[model samples]
Target: MDQRVTIEIIDGVADVRLVRADKMNALDNAMFDGLVEAGETLKLNKQVRCVVLSGEGRAFCAGLDASNFGRMAGGGGGGEPENATSRLGPRTHGISNRAQYAVWVWRELEVPVIAAVHGFAYGGGFQLMLGADMRYVTPDARLSILEIKWGLVPDMAGTQLMRHLVREDLVRELTYTGRIFSGAEAQQMGFATRVCDDPRAEALKVAREIAGKSPDAIRAAKRIYNAANYRSAADGLMDESIEQSSLIGSPNQVEAVKANLEQRAPRFAD
Candidate 1:
C-alpha cells in the first residue's frame, strides 16, 4: 500500500493520499489494490469521522497508467488467457468487479469522503473522485471522461455517479467527446463542490469542520442523503424518520444539543 497510497489519521479525520508521484498517481494494479485496502481499513475505523483524499504529485491522477495502453495496443498484457474471462465476469465484491470496487468503496464507506483535486483528473481518475461525497478542485485543474479516446467506456462507476451530478445530455456529450474541462467549468456543470486556489488546504479545512460534528449525526446524514439518491421518495422519507429515531436521545445526540446550548464544543464518543 505504501507504494501507491498512504493514510494518516489525525483529529478524527483520515487523510488518504495517492502517492505514485512519478506516474502522476495513475492507477496500475498495485494502485488499485492499495486504494481498496485503504478504503477498507478506514471503513472499519469508527474513530474516523471524515476522510480527505488527495494525490501527491503534478496531477490528481492521469487515469489508467500509460503502460495499460501499451499492453492493449500490443495485445499481450491481458493476463494469462484462462484467468481473463473469469476476472471480467465475476462479481467478486457484491455488485462490483475488482477495478470498480477500487472506486466504489469510498461511496460505501460510512464516513463522508472529500476529494481534493489539483492539476488533472482524467478518465478513471475522474470516476474515483466521483465516489467522494464532496470535491474541492483548483481552478486550473483539468478533468475529462476520457475512455472514449481509447475506444472504451467509463467502466469505473462513471455512468452511475455521473447521472447523479451531471445532466444526461452533458454526460453524453463529455463521454462521447472525451473533452477536458477546467475546474471552474466543472463547478458550473455541478461536478465540483468548490473551486479554490489551493484545493488540498481548502478540502482539509472543510474535512476538519465535518470531523467536529457529532459522528452519529454525520453518519446518519450520509446514509439518509445517499438513500435519497437511490430510493423512492416514500422510502427516502421513511429512512429519514428511521435514522432520526436511532439518533434521538442517543449519547452523542444529547451531547450535540448540550454543547450548542452551552456554546461549547461537543465531546463525542467513538
Candidate 2:
C-alpha cells in the first residue's frame, strides 16, 4: 500500500488513515490508487471486523486537488483526462467510473465502513465519504457538492449514493447549486449520521463496539441494508433469504451462538 494511505489494525478494527496532511489528503491519482488498494486489502483480511476511515492532520479531505481542474480542462500535470480512455465492464464499482473509484471502493467492501470527517470534505472528498456505511462528522466540518463550481457534475457515484440518503429534490438542489454546508446541516439533511466534537474519536469508538459483535451477523446486516436500496421489496426479501441461507449453520454463526451462551470470546473460523 502507498504511504499516502496507512492501514493499522488494533484488535479487530482496521484504522485506515489518509496521510497526505500536506495537501489535506487531496485526491490525486496516487491517493486514489492508495485508497482502492486499502479497500482491496480489507477484502481478504479475515481478522478485520470493521474499519474506521479518517485523515491525519486537521482536515478529512479537501476534495479533488483543486489543481486537478486544470488537468481536466486539458492543461498540464494532473495527468491525462479521466475520460481519455474508455475500458469495458463496471468501471471500478457501480455508477463510478474508474476515475471515481478512489472513493467508491469503500462501498464494495463487505464489511461496514465508517468515515470520520472533519474540517473540509468538499467536492470529490464529500462524495468519497458517501461510500462509507456511516459518516461521523465534526460539527464544524465543511461539506459540499462543489463540482458545479467548476462547471462539472458529481461524477463519483455521488448522485447514486445521495439518492438513498437524502431527498431527491435536496440532492438536486445541492448538486446543482454546489452549496457548502456544515456538518450540523448535513446531519439534518441525512448526509451525516451524527456530528461530534471529535468525529474520529467517536467513529473509532463505534467501530470498536461493532468489532465486538458477531462478524457474520454484521456482514448479513450490511448486505440487507445495501439490498434494501438497490432492490424492490420482494427482491430484497429474497436477498435476505439467500444471505441468511449462507450464514445459517455456518461455523462462524454457530460459534457466535456458542460464545453468547458461554459469555466468552468467539473463536470464529476464517
Candidate 3:
C-alpha cells in the first residue's frame, strides 16, 4: 500500500518491487513500512502462491539510507529518526520490530519468496536478500554484510537469517569485516541460490514454475521447511505426515493427479 513498495499479482505469483531507484532502493522507515505492508497484504491473499521480489533501478537495495547512519549514532539533526520514541526491542510485528519485519516478512509468507538481486545488495540490503527462500543474483552484483563498515551490526534479522544460509565462521568473518563480495562468490559461499546474467528473468521463470503447482502443496512445503530448521527429526517427520494427511484426497491434490493423468493443465482453487 505504501508508495515506496508496490505489489502486483498475476496468476498465482506476486511480483513485489522496491521502487526507490533514486536512492538505489535504500531502506528508510518508510521503505521498511512499505515492505512490511506489502508482505502482510499478500499473506492474507490465498491466491498468492509465490512471490518474486526485486528492486527497480540500478541496484536491488543499497542498505540503510546513508542519512540514517548519522542519526543511528545520535548525531544527525536534520531528519526525524524512524520514530525516535520507538525502541527496537519490542516485537512490533510478530517477533520482529518494523524494520526487521521488512526482511522477516518474506520468511513468514506461506509461499516461497524469491529474490532477484542485481547491482549491489549492501548492509541491510544483503540481509534483505537472506529473507527470501531463494536468491537469484547477477554474477557481478555486489553483496556484503555491511554493518561492520559503520561499526554496527546487521540488526535487521541478518544474524538469524545468515546462520541458516552460511557457516558460522563465514558469517563471523563477513559480519566482522563488512567487505563486499560478488554474487558468483555468494553462490559458492551459499548466500545465493544462483548467479545469472539476468537474475530477474530467471527468478520469474522459477516463480512461474512454482506458481503452477498446487497451492496447498506449496504452502505446506514452505511450512514444513521453515519448521525443519529448528525442530527435531521426529517432529519434522510428524509434520510431514500431518501435512500429507491433510493434502491426501484434497480437491487440489486430486486435481493435480487428474491433470497429470489427463495430460492437461490443472485448474487449482485458491
Candidate 4:
C-alpha cells in the first residue's frame, strides 16, 4: 500500500501531500493516523517556516471512506472495538477527539499552512481545507459540505472553522444542503483565497514568499489571527501587544531590519 501521507521539506517549506490517489486520498483508518502523525511532526520542527498541503493525482480528498461508515454503522467508527466504543465523545487527543484532531491539528500548527486543492474537497476533506491559513483551488474544482447527504453533520471541527471563514447564514445554508459548489463559487463565497489553473504551484510560490519573512513574526501573526476568531477584542489587543513586544529587537527581527537596509535576503534562525 502507498503511504497515506508524505512530507518533504525544502527551504523552510514542508510539502505535505496526501498520497493515496487511488482512493481519492480518502480518510481510511490509516490515513487519519498518518495525517495526525504528520501534523505533530511538523508542529515540533522549528526548521519549518511554512507548509503547503496537497494531494497526489486526482482530487484533494473525497472525504471519509465508505468502509469507515460501515464501521460506524456497526456501532463503532474505528473498526477496532476499543476505539469504536466512543470514537468521537472521548478527548482522545488533547481537547479534541481523535477525528477532530486530524483536522484541528492544522489550526494548531504554529507556522502558516496553504492548501493546494484540485479535483474536489468534500465532507471531511472540505473541513481539512478550511484548516489552512490560505487555500488555492482550480477554477472548476468541485467542493461540498457533504456530511448531510450521508445522514451526518460536519463533525470534524468544520463547525468551528466555518464560523470564522464565512457568514453565519452561508454556513447554515451549506451545512443544511451539502450541495456541491465550484471553486469559482468558493472564491466568491470567501472559502478560497485564489482560483488558478495550477493551484499547487501557486501555493508553493506563496509558501516560499512566506518562508522568506521573519519566522518569529510570521508565527506571532498566525497566533493573533487564530485567537481573533474566539477571543474578546480586549484579549486580542493584549495578545498583539505581547507578541509585538517579544518580536521587537529579537535576533530574527533585527536581522530582518538589517537585511532590508542592506537589500539582502534575511537569514533567520530556525
TM-score of each: 0.83, 0.80, 0.81, 0.81
lDDT measured at residue 44 in model 3 versus the true structure, 0 to 100: 97
Screening candidate 4 with a backbone cut-off below 3 angstroms (N, C-alpha, C), the clashing residue pairs are none
Global Cα lDDT for candidate 1: 0.81
TM-score order, best first, reads 1, 4, 3, 2
Writing each residue's lDDT as its tens digit, candidate 4 over 85-198 gives 233445667656667778879988999999999997999999899889999999999999986554456767777777777999998999879899999999999999999999
Best candidate according to lDDT: 1
How many Å off is the CA of 27 in candidate 3?
0.4
lDDT value for model 2:
0.77
Candidate 2 lDDT over residue span 140-217, tens digit each: 899999865554556666766787899999999998798899999999999999989988899889999999999999
Query: Positional deviation of 232 in candidate 1, in angstroms?
Result: 11
Superposed on all Cα atoms, the candidates' RMSDs to the truth, in angstroms, are 17.9, 17.6, 18.1, 17.7
C-alpha lDDT of residue 86 in model 3: 35
Runs off by more than 4 Å, candidate 3: 73-86, 230-270
* Candidate achieving higher lDDT, 1 or 2: 1
- Where does candidate 1 have its weakest 10-residue lDDT segment? 232-241
User: How displaced is residue 2 in candidate 4, in Å?
Assistant: 7.2
Model 1: CA > 4 A from native: 80-85, 231-270
